[model samples]
Target: MTDAVDPPAERLLHDLGITEPGEIDVEVIACAVGAVVRYRRLGVGDARIVGLGDRAIITVDNRASRVRQRFSVAHELGHWHHHRGRRLICHGAADQQVGVAGCEREADGYAADLLMPRFMLEPLVAGVPMSFDLVYQTAAAFGVSAMAAALRLADVHPAAFALVVEEADGRRWFRRSASLNPRWFVRSAASGVSVTADRYGLSRANATFAAPAQRWFLGQGAKDAQAFQTIDVMVCGRAIHLIVVA
Candidate 1:
């Protein structure tokens, strides 16, 4: 064996208290098997994600504190663990396009997978009464950021759910799975409207949406609302524009 994952490399999952690591175990195995032949190199910066010769590169904002750095590190680890053959380079997160092939989006997904594995999260959140408080509590149990927890909760919401992120006191992130259907902008109609409008200010977590005309909040309609079961949630104490339908 020319080289391996340095032992502690795999411990990141353990440190996070993840026992069964799920696919991460497979990733670790691949990293171990490939580390000898793959010949990987790792570096970090606040630049767009890219791949060099046998290495994954990461760029980060220097003025930013450790959380971003740590997240970057974990992100780079994701590239190394899951997408090893490719030389990965990242500019961290940018103005995301609402479609696939988003590196930032992939990194966010990978980070969630690594830190909050299905093995750990699946059992904890099951039947855990959907609520912003409940979601936050589950996230705390996993030792991940509230936003991370919120994202996971939104991603894995049982019936139908979506998560909204607000930047500058407005919603900036939107996520909806197959179980949900939300126009979300029948009120704004703008291409990218700030989610902090007074329309959402009155919104609270666990609120259900079945509204007829309203897209942001739960409407009281039974049929239209039956299309999805919408719920509201918040992130980092900021309002999270949420919708769960059908």
Candidate 2:
């Protein structure tokens, strides 16, 4: 039998009377969901959820940044609400890909929506130029990491925007805005080199420049070989490249 489905994050936030675009107190939301929040020195990951009788205990990594702690707490609460009775350990951006694991993806989606509600984010990003400055502003307003803010913008913005994140070891993941055509696949260089990698080599933390679409996408026809503007931002030692295609 199929598992019972929980409500989406939007409905959950609405039911909790959260309609504004600002910092969401995930601790308060956890209490409302009957989960206890605690802090401990977790190993490398963000947090874990353990089912205790009818309630759950969420233990967050004390050493993580404040924004990561917030997202971790919200992700554990997602487990409480969606996958009850299953103990879950969550890694932050390290495991947040499109389709690596089902539960992790669901919980990440829940955390993203709960933290940055689309209804609120849509209006906030409307007419704003797609740039790292806008992403930093949004992250400050929403109390989420700059990476999270960039991902949210790529998810909801009406324009064709794409965000690619690369780790120190050359591993990468990417997400594109709704208006972007699905056929476009981001290309990885022979040695995992990318625009963000080049910027990192120069010790640049933030930059905006123009490059041919082929620099990012693979198999681009002449018709699609236009110039694309890229905004690169370094967050917590990871490279976040935001590409705006015209």
Candidate 3:
């Protein structure tokens, strides 16, 4: 099993005196870490970090959503904390490209931890039934996007759950909770369209239902297993699916 990487991020939040589900002021954290944050109308990427000795400058695209901007700021801060003296450019949700670099994924994980500290999120999700409403509520509580909250929940939820973020062009990314068996593999159509995609196309927003596990997983166990609850939401033309095993 792989080790979790949220401890350092949690420690940073601890040092910042943030111990609850509330707004995480990324700008303040950047300044505290000796970085200057500037908002610009960036054309190529959502954000980037440029280092100069002990200090750095973080440039964020002003065109992105407020929540996206917050995550971008936190992502740059992660780079500063973990990969000092290295410059990075981050593409936002609007640019849904497949495949993320190791450093980029690590920075995203750190940002998720920093924005939604495990200490606070664990208790909030404990014993709570899984649903799109729950994810949205958690997102509101943490002042993050629903997709971000869903991804965090997949990492922390005690149950066997998986969160899949699929783009319109068929490329996708998924995260599974530790409880899920390592051999399980999620299934996706060649065209990237599924029942969830159909619902998303109709509503272009909220949709939740239950489907056979084989609809998403092709393994023998998944084919014979019972149904799983699927909650989906559309974000920036991407379909985010939250599947909870029964």
Candidate 4:
């Protein structure tokens, strides 16, 4: 998302003089915003927030990874800021997808903004090309999942690319940069034979290759596809491709 989208999160960072990624202490920030963060084994959701007036308590799942815990805290903080006076239980990132409720998406956006504000993330990805290395690096630096970093990078990075996640069952979804042509719909894993599918489980040292636009695109975009390339890498047994316009 753009820097202008959420003013409260950005304003909070500004008020606290938080200019660096490591400075974003979600617990501390939550406390500053009248919320107390707690950790426990949550059986129902990743996190939950209960608010009374200005003060609130955020409970996160302790069994989750540190990055996940951080995101849960930030997400509850989002609900605390936007949906105060109401109790909420969030399942996880899957609930943050497009078709979910507006409130959930809003909270997700808030969490993203709070965790990886554009002001901080932009500079990190300023001139870097999108790749698994860049995504993993950003994830490490920001204490977020590679998926989150990839989506955020696609949002702020000045490149026309897409981060595609293909499941073992061949299901797929993607997040594309704004500069990517609107017509460039990614081809489904089952619809066509692709080098990416064939190259999985291989070393990533020379994974980057020039492939025909038709190899990745479909319909109008495929017909008018520009010179493009892909960097396919196996991330946690899932096929991840960084499709970049060449």
Candidate 5:
């Protein structure tokens, strides 16, 4: 019996010689799907598909400096190949994308899995040194953006991880996985709400500090069942740290 989920998208990624980061083939994917592949400084795109009824339109905005349009194009093509006939529009920085669960998130996962397969990420993450420059270089090696690399590392790497992005003005959106067991009780004294990455990582940072040390947590079923860890990272630039605890 056929599995409920489609495996062709992933299978094509591997078969197309894109089993690593830098090996994305935007042109090929564009040709295959009859989509137009172009580069622009248009702010954001992690594979956005304009799924008009009759045919699907795919476009990848290469505006961001961190990741290449190649991966973006491939990412869009992921939606085209697997999610054809469905209108999928992905906006914002790959890191700051809105909503936690649903098609957008699923497509993002699919994009990462396709562009930076576990096979390549495992060995690469295991062997490579961790640093901003080195990390950027690795992302370059994979032909993906730095943020994209960080996202993948957070998933497969055993170390505790957190990705912080700083835009022109301040902190944007940041997500910490289970490995990053942040302290949950430390609610903001002012707002009384749980502090998120955008609150500190980008929004508030400015002239003074280069790096900040803070803690956050991921809550489980019960209030007490929260995971916590301390994240020490840079104030600006895209920072991904291998935290101490898991």
Candidate 6:
């Protein structure tokens, strides 16, 4: 499992005296780390970083959403912190894959810790039930996308849950809650639980409902099927399902 607290980013936050979500100013943080963030019209990628010694320049696409731009800047800061004196170009699909490069994954993890620090996020999610509403609320509070919020929630929320993202083409990726058992693996699909759009382009969203454990959990008995529940949300041609053990 990836460490929930990024020592460097967390130490940076602490050193900067950031104690709340509103205090996570990516540009200011970048400046503190000796990187100057700039916005430009990019034809290829979402963001890039070029660094020499301690000073660096991070260029992010100006056309992206505010949340995305912020995340992009934070991601480049991650690169600047870890892989300094190097150049890298990153894509905009922040929640697209689990099998990314080691360095890219590192940067993504750093960005997550920077944007939604454990100190601030864990308190809000503790003892609260996992659902779409909670995810959206967290997103709104942190100025991040729902997908980013969901992934970070899974990382910090003390629950046995898994977030599954199914693409329009049926490709899937998932992030497991920290408390989830490693022995339990997620299935490709849950039959009655419609994660993607159907023939009429209709999909389920904004509600938690029952789904068979066998349908979502691999190698589960019928007796255990009733203990599982799911909340589905649709975003940008993708379907995200929050599977929880009740």
Best by TM-score: 6
Instruction: Please list the Cα RMSD from the true structure of every candidate, rounded to 1 decimal place.
Output: 8.8, 4.5, 3.4, 3.0, 7.0, 2.8
Model 4 alpha-carbon drift over 4 Å, by segment: 1-6, 93-101, 168-170, 194-199, 202-206, 219-238
RMSD from true fold, candidate 3: 3.4
The models' CA-based lDDT, in order, is 0.48, 0.72, 0.73, 0.74, 0.51, 0.77
- Model 6: pairs clashing at backbone N, Cα or C within 3 Å: none
Summarize candidate 5's per-residue lDDT along 1-246 as a digit string, tens digits. Answer: 124453455567656656544455657656655777655546454446566553555655565443545555665665666667765456622442434456556656767766666666667667554434545556667777666666666666655545444334433445454455555322111123343344456434322222212333334422433222222234335333322222
At residue 45, candidate 6 shows an lDDT of: 79
Error of 3 at 188 (Å): 2.4
Candidate 3 on 217-245: residue-level lDDT in tens? Answer: 66658867655555464565667777777
Q: Give the candidates in order of lDDT, highest first.
A: 6, 4, 3, 2, 5, 1
Local accuracy of candidate 6 as per-residue lDDT tens digits, 1-246: 235555688779989999999999999999998889899998877888888888888888999888889888888877877877555556643542577876788888888888888888878887898888888899899998888888888888887888877777878888888887677777766656555645324344554577666567765353375544544545566677778876
What's model 1's lDDT at 59? Answer: 44
Q: Which lDDT value does model 6 have at 243? A: 82
TM-score of every candidate relative to the true structure: 0.56, 0.84, 0.85, 0.85, 0.60, 0.89
Instruction: Name the candidate that leads on lDDT.
Output: 6
- Greater-lDDT candidate between 1 and 6: 6
What's model 4's TM-score? 0.85
- For candidate 1, lDDT tens digit of each residue in 42-126? 2444333445455434444555444344444455555555565654455553222234365556665666666566556667767
Residue 206 CA displacement from its true place in model 6, Å? 1.8
Expressed as tens digits, the lDDT of each residue in 84-123 for candidate 4 is 8765555754423434577788888888888888888887
* Model 5 alpha-carbon drift over 4 Å, by segment: 1-9, 17-22, 39-57, 61-68, 88-101, 127-134, 164-173, 177-242
